[model samples]
Target: MANVYLKEAIRTMETSSGTAANYEYASTSCQGWRNTQEDVHLILPNFDSDTSLFAVFDGHNGIEVAAYVAKYLPEYIRQNRKYKRGRVSEGLKEAFCLLDGQLLLVDAVNELRAIRRQAHPELPEYKPGITSGCTAVVCLLKKDTFYCASIGDTRCVLCRNGKAFPLSIDNKPDDANECARIMKAGGEVVHGRINKLINVSRAFGDHMFKMVPNMSTIEQMIIPLPDVIIEPYIESTDSFMVLMCDGIWNSMDNSEVIDFVGSRIQKKMPLAKITEEVIKNVLPKEMPPSGIKGKDNMTICVIKFKGKRGGVGSTNMSAMPRTTVRGNNGPNKHH
Candidate 1:
């Protein structure tokens, strides 16, 4: 039997705003066959009781970035001007981008590198922080609008009616467009890979692999955090949505998740139970062993909406259809 460790957060039907969360979040960790490479968090903002949601912060280069984001991002949103009481989407955009920028200030990285050098003067090849990279996918759903952003290979997907929409894109070096841009900037996408190691084209805290002072990080490049996908709501939409990391997707596609969830929904299964099934069923296919290196963690979150009405008898999936969005890794990418 496959073992799955899961953590999740679901917005209450009636939030402090006296409104429904209509939004939910989940984070999970699976050491699995591979060592634990994933760290995730679902954070709720204090400002908007009506906000009905939080975000998933997935970390790679250790849990530092993810931990950093989980600690400060929500607080940042609460103080930002754009994050007016109910402006969930706008607030999310500002918070996510702002957090991405904050990584450069991780002064400890250089210090850690210094310590490593001192410990192994002869083995100069040991670079402590360079090979570290992470992906992040953030989603915020308030009332009728859904906001999303992502970086790296992690993803965010939405399901409305029976159709599926991908809210986030994979930012890999092999991607022709990303490759072209990297090359144009005097940077090479070596080995048919963006950074010659990981596939993600943009990320946070991969100090060594970053393009340097001239190229700048996603924050400095003025690259918006992953684009936001917003959809309205009508009557025909499902009442629940799922958010998960790549571990789940490695085995299950949108249709598969939808089918499983749909059947469970008909059976009136609890949201938590449904999410557990996903983790139980979908673990990575070829993970490494105890001492071997591979992906770190797996996180999942599921949101279930209630009583969505679009005036009179409207069935617009675009308007709304219980959507499932997922985010993974650490920093929000600009792909």
Candidate 2:
């Protein structure tokens, strides 16, 4: 087994809540059984007058990449030409690829080390290169629609009249499409993991796997491409949505999670409590040494849509993007 597990789990949580034009949201994160807390999230309840953005970055190897993405991704997305032209979906995909490319440069690598320095002054072993990476799952609310962009195992689920609808596909090496890409790049998938190292097929950072001698970034063994999904909103039928990392999914299925959160909503439980409670209920009592599904970092973002009677059609899965602005990444507040 890997040597990243700690003797004890960290239960302390970082929680926040906010409201947007049509929904209210709350997010919670815990370090859990990992050696350190590498997961970080961004909540943009009012990204603009009509748009909102929520994202979770599940970092691997270190927290620097996740932290960097949380703080600067919005700016990069906004700066993209497609985003400026109202092509939110296209902008999101390009922004992800563009940012991953930037992270490989010397300046970007140095900045990542600086972020780590700020978080952990005692652990100064981040050398002059970048090997860390993060799985990003983002939910964008614009008008009466939802656009989700994701890479890796982090997921977004829509609850429609107590039913569950997955918005994004989990990119894994074992999946046929992902497997083909890896094999085309001359990389081997051993035991479901990429080169017996990372499990997810795509993510930010991780320049080591991405550096193929003469291949373009997208043609590398591991790329930064994201699968985007577009879902039309039906306020009458859709109740809420959940965006979380593999930590929560490892313990519960899509239906189980919708039911758990739905029942709590019926009782008028606060959104923040529901988020924290899910983590508390799903966290393993005794994490296994392998740390596959159990005892990993956990993060959950709950967005509840306000009822308005008559509604619309089913959720759609497609490629997408969103608008710009700074977000509330603080505690007890979301604006």
Candidate 3:
């Protein structure tokens, strides 16, 4: 039975600045044999001064958690006191933890249910036992620096000088640290799943996995804490960054994606077009033994940086107007 809530969708957003660093980004979500489209994204060009934020959220069980993060993570980070004080790393960590905490609140859960009901009235009502969650990978470009934060399987990778450099690590249940933590918290890892249910050991809003008697938040079977990476962005050497869900990674490795995108960029293809091609490459042509073809919602975000240098100057200039294009929920192309 095909999931009625699942559909193929594409969204593109782009911005170019004559003064600061310019960026081009696009995202595509294909049901691709899945029952639901649980992937969501965020693209905020020149979010503040010289900073830009991009992220991919891959939801499991339900889309509410992913949608909530896509809607609020950036705002939470920007409003953080640490971010205002120029502490990007601290600010991001604080923001991720805070957002996870907020998801457990009664008001937050109610709001998510309301939004889901409004978006998909055909779906069943939200119940107390319903447990949903999402994985997040975020890239924040501030001045000449880049910050990457991730939890769960979604990943952020940088392509520099035609080579792939991972910005975030995949948090899986089989990892030694994750397994140790889960065991200590009275949770068992069975077949690479936390309690034989969730695969990723760190994510946002898996309330069931997070509920451990007398255990601290960090000691839960699955924690919302993210692994963050900070690096200097070299305009001359760095090419672009790829943020994607596990669906892409499950089919293609990091190097393969980088090479594919690099080859397309060499042909002078638009960033949005490159993203479309990537999605197509991962989408399965025929249904296989797994019952579904692709079996996952593939979402990709490509951020192509302008080769210009220099941070936002003293002149307070407004950002370029963002243009968004959405494609129909079918195998269609939109420029």
Candidate 4:
């Protein structure tokens, strides 16, 4: 098994609306089959006890872009005015777009430009920009809502009562509708990947190679725009979630993870240890995927709503009964 390092972990108590909103969260990053790449995540305690969390920052070129998002994106929300009102989701969307625009605002594309500029101002590559890029799958949980948004393949899955539900859809080059839109706008979808380069058509970086016509700026060059999904809680404490990067999904499917996690929770196992075991069990013993070419980075964060006061019988996670739902459960494997 690979020796994984979970960069950060925390569980904080929350209070909202003059009342206590109990919450517990834990996260870790693993070097999934790749040595150079590192995954990053954070649970930002922001805005009146709401939880803002993200995972699967798949970095390309260098880890700078992903690292930047992990460290600073949450700060934007805390500082942005719009987020203070009821428009937190919209604020986050604009923040992402603005971040890309700000990247292209500078004059250089090297990762170490800032450091170099400070150290030796005469260096040409010391300009104030970098070409690095990263994808983000973020979730903001407030009250009983799960507000989710994504830029790439890193996904969010919600599970309740032993069933799998998708919380976000991956944005890929081959998405037929997206492909048609790109082609109509004179963009090419080559070899199942947009412009025959990045597998994910929309992401936070790669301003150097995006759509043309100077099309809607470099950011929109890869844009159908990011997606935002908000859903009511499933209401069953037995329900849990798996937020992961592509590596875990590549080797296993929704059913596999849901079954594993569900079975463990049913056996009264802690989500924290179960998450760690999932990574340890999946990683091979002899040849860890790390350092191997073509192996993507891996990371996973799971959240389970625990009952209040006493235990399971108190406030289990049962979806406030729904009507006209598509799957057996709400949003199962569809997000």
Candidate that beats the other on lDDT, 2 or 3, i.e. the better one: 2
- TM-score: which candidate is best? 2
Q: What digit string (tens of lDDT, one per residue) describes model 1 on residues 226-266?
A: 54555554435545555656655656776677678768767
Candidate 2 CA-lDDT value: 0.79
Lowest lDDT 10-residue stretch of candidate 1 = 9-18
Q: Model 2, stretches more than 4 Å misplaced?
A: 121-129, 289-291, 308-335
What is the Å distance of residue 255 in model 4 from its true position?
Answer: 2.3
* Residue 181 alpha-carbon offset, candidate 2, angstroms: 1.1
Query: Can you list the residue pairs that collide in candidate 3?
Result: none
Q: Could you tell me which 10 consecutive residues in candidate 4 have the lowest summed lDDT? A: 326-335
- Candidate no. 3 TM-score: 0.84
Residue-level lDDT of model 3, residues 1-335, one tens digit each, is 23532343332223222222466666666656665567888778778977888888998876888899888898899899988998777677778778888886788888789766765566665542137889998888887677888889899988978899888888888988889988988889998988888899888888788777776666778877777777777766678889989888888899999999999988998776788788788876654455322557788877777676575343332232221111011111101
Model 4 scores a C-alpha lDDT of 0.58
> For each candidate, what TM-score against the reference?
0.70, 0.88, 0.84, 0.73
Q: Comparing 2 and 4 by lDDT, which wins?
A: 2
Q: lDDT of all predictions, in order shown?
A: 0.52, 0.79, 0.75, 0.58
Candidate 2, 1-335: lDDT as tens digits: 34677788888889999876567889999988887788888888767656688898998877898888888888887688987788777777778877877786787788888887876565545542256789999887777777788888898999986899888778889988788878888899999998998898888888788766766666667777777887777666689999998888998888988999999999999999999999999877887656467588999999898764222333332222332221111121101
- What local lDDT score does residue 312 receive in model 4, on the 0 to 100 scale? 31
Runs off by more than 4 Å, candidate 1? 1-28, 43-47, 85-94, 106-131, 190-192, 219-224, 284-296, 308-335
RMSD of each: 8.4, 7.1, 9.7, 8.6
- Candidate 1 C-alpha error for residue 62, in Å: 1.6
Q: Rank the candidates by TM-score, best first.
A: 2, 3, 4, 1
